[model samples]
Target: MAEWVHDLGGSRGFGPVEVEPGEPPFHADWERRVFGMTATVMAQGRANGSEFRHAIERMDPGWYLASPYYEHWLTGLATLLVEKGVVDREELEAHGAPSFPISRAAARADVPPGAQADPFAVGQRVRVRSFEPRGHTRCPGYVRGHRGTVVRRDGDHTVPDVEAHSEERPAEPTYSVAFDATELWGSEAEPGATVHVDLWHRYLEAVE
Candidate 1:
């Protein structure tokens, strides 16, 4: 499976994650403003959470890798605001703000309740599907094709893979699956180590 720039989990060459002690959430005023704007857009029903994330995934690989985290948020917000016809490119550049007091009365009207049955059970072994999707997916590339034990059933939720592109948010069961480190990272991984991931039902299949 060809990995997108955003799916860098378990990839090599990048340096170790450096943690800043006592780090603040926002580094600048613009980042805080961007976050608030994004929240407002979602509240207005102009966009959904999955749609917002897909917009970031659709960014140019070069710019995506080179930019900071909040910049990605800004880019996603801007893209959705334009695509949803809430604002045009000209108006966005000229005023850099959307009209105030947006409404959420009919938010997520297209999404119906989840009616799917849960097939897999706790402790059941399952394998992540290996197919490549051209659009947004919550499934991480590293877990694809690997077998894992379903540790917990997380109930039904909207499938991000579909919600990103379409207005309808069909529901599906999700599970917390536990995989041994060696299964994903080979023998070099630490002994007795395991990684847990929350995956949608469609991403897994019965291990036969």
Candidate 2:
């Protein structure tokens, strides 16, 4: 599977991480405002976490790479506001609108489905199923088709793929699967190392 530009967990060529010691969380006032807006939007249930993430992922790759971290949040917020009909594109462009609360109907629309039965057990061998997703997915590109052992069951959680584009928050069992470093990166990876990934039930299949 082709890696989405937003999902660069294990990829290379991005250079070293420069840490800003004692850095303030917000660089500018506008960034703080964007954070507030995002908090309010999510608090009011205008959009879910997965939906917001997918909106950021939907951004143009070049723009995404060029933009700052908070700008990505701002862009995702704007996209959700417009898509949810809370604000129109023209009103958003004008940037002079009165604030209104999100409707209760919208908040209550995503009543979560019942919890699903756990399909895989702890210490069970499984393989991540590889598939091309048409929409958002919690399954990362790096782990697809990889064999791993389920080390922990994370219980039921909302499936991101379903929540991203729809009003449904279906429950599914999640697991922390541990993959050997050498299994993923060949002999270059250090010995006695493992990478653990939290994955949903649907992403894995039992390996006999």
Which 10-residue window of candidate 1 scores lowest in summed lDDT?
100-109
Query: Candidate 1 on 139-204: residue-level lDDT in tens?
Result: 788888999999999898988877877766687789999999999889888999999999888888
Off by over 4 Å in 2: 8-10, 96-118
RMSD of each: 6.1, 6.0
For model 2, how does the per-residue alpha-carbon lDDT over 1-208 read when each residue is reduced to its tens digit? 2466777353456789779999999999999999999999899988889888877877777778788998899878887787778877678656743542111122222222333434798889999887757567777777888899999998889888788778766778889999998887789889999999998888888898
Query: Once all C-alphas are superposed, what RMSD does model 2 give against the true structure?
Result: 6.0
Candidate no. 2 TM-score:
0.85
Residue pairs clashing in model 1 are: none
Query: What TM-score against the true fold does each predicted structure earn?
Result: 0.86, 0.85
Best by lDDT: 1
Instruction: Give per-residue lDDT, candidate 1, residue 97.
Output: 48
